[model samples]
Target: MIAIIADDLTGANDTGVQYKKNGYSTTVKIMNDNDVSSSMFKTSDVVVINTDTRPLSKKDAYDCVFKLAEKLNSVNNLEYIYKKVDSLMRGNPAPELEAILDSTDAEIAIVASAFPDNGRIVTDGTLLMPDNKHVDITNIFNTETKRKAVNVRLINVREGAESLKQYMEGQMENGADIFVFDTVSNEDLATISDAAMLIGKKKIFCGSAGLAKQLGRKKKAEQKYDGTVFIVVGSRNAATAHQVRMATETFKLPVVLVNSEEIIDGRYEKAVSESVEKAKEYYLNGNKVVIIAIDSLFEEYTVVLRATATENAKSLKVAESLGDIVKRLYEHIKPVTFVATGGDTAFQICNFLGSDGMELVDEIVPGVPIGILREGMADGSSMVTKSGGFGDEDTLVKVINYLMVNRK
Candidate 1:
């Protein structure tokens, strides 16, 4: 059985869903679950454990993963273990990685957290965001523990699996505990995965969903939407704002921006009704893609001037209002697919649509996972969920085009 160990619940779910999409009998279990036995591993092809250690102290995180890794290493049916880190290097990664190394027979951990489809890549051992902003990997991890890392440059990775394997073996011989690879695409991650397999039991894979997806590829084949692609952007992220602008101005998609300020103040009924009407009009007028997004213009001003008590309260209310609009839109027209950006927005919309969960399918891009509503009015309908800060300016256009191309 394949194992994925993640920091939190969402991280575990997303990674486990990748294996599920690839036709694996996947199960995501909490780390403290009593039934995480060999029988559970025997029945499933992949088992993901959520350690819930992101907010813990470094020592606590290490202890948590260490105990879990020890139990996993004791299991005989285990094929390989994947340590899932955040793409952005959030939480206590360094300590958790070290704990895995300490517990398992694996001598070196290979780290490649690049999800190029979401515009996150590693260059020269540095993590780069979608906007091409450089993020230092070492600094993001807990400063309490020092991470000893060796860089496997893109040049080395491009030289094929054998060469990459040889370099990693040499690094291991030289006392390198962790190997951080430079990757700018999914193919690069595949290469790294190949090299790790070539190295065999002496090593463990450590990365984000990008590397985990490559591991899933070994189990199954490489792998959409229809009708009007309804998009809801409730993110205040600047990256999403640029994407919305690109979709409207460049792709000529129609967008109706809702008054977020009014939504938070509970006076958004009129605005929500108008937005819904405009969205339906766009769909009926031969527009394949229609968007209902929270107005970004009022985000900053409203947060500072409004008496919402806290930004969290304001965000929740806005999400609720957006969900209400989407719920009402379903009354008029049933779009072939639903695209939701922002976690809160997506959750609220799904809750409003009567869905408790999303069935794992495939990704429109690397990080942007497309699923189906598990139990709702839109049950079995195509749905895509994206992080607010993920993707480029043309990301939404790519998503729409992907849905169009894959429509059945």
Candidate 2:
């Protein structure tokens, strides 16, 4: 009788699948904002949390875990402990849980994966960050001095474009040579040719979503950007990130992994702002800026703003804040193309642009809607009346992948 808590549907499914495969009697629940009763706690022996059963904020997730623990501990003082699984592992642990576990005396185990030898967590844990240090993209870039030539493929849209802009700036500051391909059409060969002309080196190529799949089909060492370092940003562990990694490896491209979970850590708002500012600075310093956002999800904070707003006044206030940020950002660096990701972001952007509503043309990314804004909407009219299909971790992955690979 093992309890498995998931933060989302995908995590719940994945964890349930793994436990079933391992011959464990597991019950995976997609957690909502609620308390777990003591009776629910008495049913399981080994609980696996896939970071899905809770919200995005670490504080919220930690609070939920604490509540769960309190409810469970009352029934049976089960030896409470925290466990971390790797990106390659079947169970994906939430970062917030890792933080909560760090604060407790409960036994922590890093089962199967290599644990950080000198990390804050002791050796008793199975998996650890390399060298016991939190992995940072900034540190990775600074460690290498020789300029590496890389090609970046941006899908192009609005949502998390600022993060990519910031990452590109960071790479340029670290003296890495970068080439960007603004392709929303999934034309990999064309993008490769464009990248060849821009940078003239074929060492690395970074892309996301459909772009990664396009690259995956090519013969290894056959394209203009052969033996490239491939990076994919702004997707989930199962979806874009995993696919891109496989494609890069299959095509014999050198790969450096950067997930969104790794980018902001606990300070999401600050990270987003910092990334946007960095991109602006890079553009001002005379570097070419190529931002690729597949859709409106690139500007997720805007979506969050819309989601947080229940009333028209609240929505207007949030939209006004977003408008200010966008205006300031555009003043510094105007992206060549603003690609919108999901329908919600597109609607919000269109609303911001004084459109009525967007038309649903296609679902660009699976489980995400892509649409065009309707004509003749009044200015300041709220388009995103209610928010749906927003996955914080998935969105974070998408943002980070774009930044890490596209960084100059």
Candidate 3:
């Protein structure tokens, strides 16, 4: 079994889908502060555990990865382990990589955080822009936060992994933790993978989705569909609310703003049924996208916030209610694509559908990826899970248009 330690749920699914597409039965666990149970995972193959530690401090991130790697190592048949960092290098990856190396038997840590498809590349051991501009990897880490003292060095991929490994060993003699590997294209990815596989000694790998995608990738069957796309707003953000309003008014999409007050007042079942039926009314009449947002129907979001004692509790209830609505909608018509905003909301819907981890195929906007449901509902159904705070105005329009254009 292979264990992947990811920093977030979306990153977990994106990397796990790489293995799943290549014929490995992979499952992604939204890990938290809980007991790591064998029954909670698919023991026969790959398991990607999401630590959800992007927002955590360096020390906390390190502890989380160290504990998770230690707990998962108890399971036999461990093929390999990798730390899935943010492709754009947003999280506390340095410490997490260090933690994995500290806890596991891995001696060398090789990192490749570039995906050329997304225009991220590594040139001369530093991240490069699509336009060949060098990105100062140190700037993001050095000034943003206080990081642990480790050997922050890189290896030129042109020299090959054998040389890189030798460099790592030399640095290890000096107490080095990890070495960032250079990769400019798919060929570079293959070279790195080949080098890692040939290494006689055990080592940890630290990389982004690009490396994972290349390690075990297979072509998916062509999407076969002419279907509607459902957009469910499960997170509260002023930007998303603006985009939702834009899409509804400009595209004339039907809006089904769920009443959060009713949901909080012991009226969930009826609220879900009514919302689904109303959305279906427009959906059956040929509308492609239906907006399901809470509090927008009866009151503004600020009013809802003022009424609720705990904002998180309200969001959780609304997320579940929206999930119930989507589950009911699936009974009537399976959407070609489902856009679920917010992490908890997406997780709830995915758990309800009994889906295997997501297979990331494309992206609608920056930091927002669209992936296929590996197991649940239909074979080609696509899902877009976005955090509530990301994306700009017209982001929803761009998302829906992208879905419509690619709704195969």
| Candidate topping TM-score | 1
- lDDT of each residue in 1-408, candidate 3, tens digit only: 677888876677656666656666666666744646455455436777878676567788888888988876665667678888765566677778767767777766667777665567765456754234465554433343343223233344557768755655566677644556657777777677777777677767677767877676574533433577778887666657887888888798888878777998889988988898998998878887778877653234431211233655666788789878887888788755788876666776776676645655554565466776756665457788765545677788888777776655
Estimate candidate 2's alpha-carbon lDDT, on a 0 to 1 scale: 0.32
Point to the candidate with the largest lDDT.
1
TM-score of each: 0.70, 0.28, 0.66
**Ranking by lDDT, best first?**
1, 3, 2
Please give the lDDT score for candidate 3.
0.68
RMSD of 2: 22.1
What is the Å distance of residue 173 in model 2 from its true position? 42
- Give the range of the ten consecutive residues with the poorest summed lDDT in model 3: 298-307
lDDT of 2 by residue, 12-38 (tens): 332233333333333333233253444
**What are the per-residue Cα lDDT tens digits for candidate 1 across 1-408?**
888888854466567667776778676555654545687676568877777676567788899899888888878868778898877776777889888888888777788988776667888888865455566664444243454577789999999999999998887777676788899988898899888888755666888777777765443323345677888988777777878888888778888889877777777788788888888888889988888898872243211111223765777788888888888888777756878886567767777988755555565665676766756787777777776667777888888787877866
Assess candidate 2 and give its TM-score to the true structure. 0.28
How far off is residue 149 in model 1, in Å?
Answer: 3.5
